[model samples]
Target: MRFGGFKRLRRFSTSRRLWVALVLLALLAAVLLLQQRSEPPDEDSGNGYAGLGEDAMEYAQAEPSHSLQFPGDHGPHPDYRIEWWYLTANLEDENGEPLGIQWTLFRQALASPDDEDDDSDSPWSTDQLWMAHAALSTPQDHWFDERFARGRPGPDQQGQAGVTTEPFSAWLDDWQLMSRDRDSGDLDSLSVTARGIDDDNTFGYRLDLTAEGPLVLHGVDGFSQKTADGQGSFYYSQPFYRVEGQVEIDGEMRNVSGRAWLDREWSSQIMGPAQQGWDWFSLHLADGYKLMAFRLRGGGEDGGDYLSGSWISPDGNVTNLDDDAIELIPTEHSEIEDREIPTQWRLRLPGQDLDVTVKARHPDRWLDTVFPYWEGDVTVEGSHSGIGFLEMTGY
Candidate 1:
């Protein structure tokens, strides 16, 4: 969607453009923070939030060396520059109508761990920025919204946005995803709530998710690789969730139930200089297996793509997948929000005896947020039948 006709729209303020950038690259918002530390107030650096130049040594980076710990790792890792708690549900309404929902909270540190103790007289000073995004898609229509906030990092959590490991809560304003059991680790049982407003009306959801299987870590025990040179993030997922909740849209509330996938990852930098974007997939097969795969465009082995994933058995055994084990190819395209997007894809895992074609229920599932992208529930056909979510970025 393009803004036109209004002269004021032609000269969107710097803050407005920043908000657009914040939504488009929410996970990489720390780049803006780093620039703020180096630039003057009146001057604007259009470099945006990405790329690690001189600051490479100033912050932490993901490696095959660091091991991920639960509960603590599930919370915030402020030492790293970027992290996000992402959730996507493949659900159905009481009438058996298909519905896809999403709720996410992103945290990007303005300062490295060493800068956390910087002298500041004001109690409201903060070194952390928070952002949230939520969306809902039915068979015929899609609704989405974005939010932003500022707060102090750890040891100071009395702000508008923060996460706690004890009760395990990640939130911004009234929107949050919290643990139902304080004593439970790995966030076994949890509740999620997020609300957003668009032109159509208000749409949001409150859902309960219970894990039926153990967590599946990506790459080498949660140390996911993004490029051949070893730049990546710590990635893992609770893909065996049995979700039951209520969805409220257009002032009407209805019950919903289905499967949900929870992703927790953090990194100083997930993209290299030549990388454009990525295509991520999370599918639940009919035979009780789960598949998580992604292709990092332009930032892979020998400047191609860093393709990798994880194959999770029904009993929770994980088989780490690299470029050799899987194949991801764009099969079809659709023009949405002025960009040609691959709404249909073909994925294969020869060892698992799985060869499937994934298709979006509708092409209109384009999320016209700060940076528009395609994220919607997908149906699998070919060797097996099931439902899942497909995310394609960098159009």
Candidate 2:
């Protein structure tokens, strides 16, 4: 969900990590062996071999030119290479103390783009893998956790990841985003819960989310183009969730409520070969509008990374923006996880006559996990006042 660290890997021995990694590799090898064994003797050449490589490239290059569909589109798109359901909340306890929570599920495809013959016989044959991250940050301390699982296509599997409309449940394993309604399926009242343990620290939460505003899609018609060549992902958000729930830390339950934002994005090829990482922002303004922005950091000769975002009005009107239409300037940097991260930022949108300053709620909110980075709550002001989350990866 949130790609941030390699810290956890240190706890395991080289032999143990290798053993686990080998198990996964062996599973993949077995699947490949089975596919080769099942191929018909003379039916191979006509099965689009010459076109396979080209088809894969074409699939990667095809313009994400279509508009996004809701309800139906919110479900999984196994055809894509990567996808994520990211949620962040800025909350206050019953005592009005500030707190933050994050839960995210990331999906990555292991097979090539053209490998689409449904290998449904074996549950382990799926080329998709799922990973999730959960975190809670208070003024005094920060706690985070992560999970990984192989994606299975059936209900028999415990670590399943999918979305449904009628009951409005979207989840991966015990970590979920589901409707609180006992009858109808709507985005009104929802529940989110995640649990995990690391070393001697154990953390998790069960919270209720009530939507105070409508869902908003980013970019034109939901096709969020990321690169100059028009490579992009479909993105959307629910930025006005009033949260009232409880978090369990070290077996202690604390009642809390705050604002939350939910982000859903899917793509076939997210990072190009030359892109190292990305920095993303999702802000909920005090006056009602929401802001979402991101910049992909291209490595080597790929030039500066691509940047884009959306300006959503209070009533749900979206103003899609391009790189030239907006600006994000890093003013200060701090060493986080052995990397320099800009904790202070200046944002300007000329067309909207807006300029704002952004800062992290705290510097220690850095999640030191499998894929680590800075993903914490932040405050924004100047032209607008807001509270939201700021994420920096591959720093």
Candidate 3:
């Protein structure tokens, strides 16, 4: 009789596992179907909102002067329209060859948490959407891929793609970035891993990042103003990570060590109606200084360009920069896929007496994702010499 009871228990466990697997498969299919029905904004239309500027009166707005708390704010803000965990690295292989990497996880709310009905308890019900992007760039080759998933609400049901704050983990499928010390919840030290295939070329990385400096807040107390009308985001960064790891490209692996920057921002309206897109830069100067700057195509005073940045000293002190304090100019352009992209730029910050040319290492670093853009490693020259990353959108 005891043997029979054990056999019954074993069968029950197997059946439960099978049922859970089937449920997950169904959830994934539903997410993909819904994602396909949704359309991205037309890039050529000069859409200022990136399809995110729509009225979100029901969702939470990123108000100024609200304090940002750690470990808690590190996780998802489902009440907002959009949020992202963005990380970029500039590394050199064992042979001293340069490589670039970008990993991002973005979360968008399908509906307000308050709108969740009785079906919210169902395993298939989800009001959150998660998307992730992974890319690896070589001197001549760039590989990129993206993934999407649905997020389950509640602490016990994390679904396929979600972020947890207690131990600091953010994942989609197998790609993950989490705290190195599972017992700690801080973002100072992390381990990241991701792999993807593009056009017969396989690429990925497994890196360990250790923060060397304190976190830096941008704009006014971590409230970054995006437009002249007080619209913006809660932005901050850990710009002093020392990274060492292995990166694989085209099935070839190499050991690498370098610097990385991680950015955290969330907002309901990151751009105004007239603002098209932006050109953003994160530079690591050779002299132990760092600069974060951006130029918005429109929505400034009198519908002009809006500019903002933060000049960081080696110790992580931040000096917020205004539009008049910095200058950004496109010096050269590259015609890629029939689009004229500014592959080279001249950046000037008068307050720090810094004048530098920031140019993309290679122009083919375009990410042809659902919302295509150019993002890759850049070399800084002129007054300051160093390496960093640049992201340009809206052509």
Candidate 4:
């Protein structure tokens, strides 16, 4: 079945503009708000997390030879089935209390552009669905919220949810991550703000991010291979963001400063049906080094786990590592919300003489959104020292 309340919204576009906007919001609320606390799909249910493993043969594929460009690539790729602009930060308040923040805007095509109806000229004609998630995590609690909207890009319309690249702005309602410099390119400087409510406590942040190094590309220039069958995505990141800002939790605001990371990736098909979920990490080491790595369970050569990563130097140089070069082992687990999640991990990169234990600062950093997952701040120790973020999906 289609969205519950959207079929009736198309007829109201010719009415007053204010009424049209309200109807659009009401439609989104009907579709998503009810699913806020739903359970995640079963392990053997859909393809993968949020059906990301579903086949998309009709849409544009992320080819290895397809080179990625700046400024233009910063905007939405409507021809693709899925894309996201994700940012995560590790911050410390004035009192040295550590906290974490995550802001993400995701875009999914309801139908391929080739399949769009030629007669669909109304501003309400939508072929794209947008969702945003914002969260803040403290030592004892995690606050998170989700928002949804519907839009389609065309000459005559700027939908309620969309992104533009000239100055780099992404938003769904009041929550936004925008470029500070109006003439900025390559997303070197940015400011992000969002407010979310958890139970009765409200939380959010406003931060300015400045790049200290260059943007790093993963896999072959930007085509990150995801499976043994050659499925992958166009992936790159600005992991050098130096952040200065303030965060508010439960009406209490505190000055904070630390590092942040922004990840940009788009793909038609990122995983095969055999792949369940993934465990990913992005770490900023103490002695001026960074590492990005992930393990895709059941997507490897013989139905094992697929592993790949990038070992980045201080100056933003990247050394891509294949499965044989990197190792990840879960040494501890945390039982929370009726699930056992691995909260501590032992990561070893033999090629770089690097071995580190990555442990979550707290085990309560579970995001209870439409698509649930575990994400939180992590500490790096053993042959290295620093902090970063960890994300785990599919249990």
Model 3 spans > 4 angstroms off:
1-49, 116-118, 155-157
- Cα misplacement distance, residue 224 of candidate 2 (Å): 0.3
lDDT of each: 0.78, 0.72, 0.82, 0.82
Model 3, 1-395: lDDT tens per residue?
Answer: 00000111112235445543543464456445435544654554343635544444557888786999988989988888789999999999989999999999988766654553526668766666677889998898898876767677564427678899989999988999999999988899999999987876788999999999999989998999988998888999999999999999877889999999999999877877677778999999999999999998887898799999999999999999999999999999999867899999999998899999998999999777656778999999998999999998766
Candidate 4 residue 92 Cα shift, in angstroms, is 0.9
TM-score of each: 0.87, 0.83, 0.87, 0.88
Off by over 4 Å in 1: 1-55, 116-119
Q: Give the Å error, residue 95, model 2.
A: 2.0
Find the 10 residues in a row with the least total lDDT in model 2. 46-55
Model 3 poorest ten-residue lDDT run: 1-10
Model 2 C-alpha lDDT per residue in residues 220-260, reported as the tens digit of each score = 76777765666667777887788888988789888998888
Model 2 deviation from native, Cα RMSD in Å: 6.8
TM-score of 4: 0.88
RMSD after CA superposition, every candidate: 5.4, 6.8, 9.7, 6.5
Clashing pairs in 2: 3-371, 4-371, 4-372, 4-373, 5-370, 5-371, 5-372
Query: How far off is residue 183 in model 4, in Å?
Result: 1.6
Model 3 steric clash pairs: none
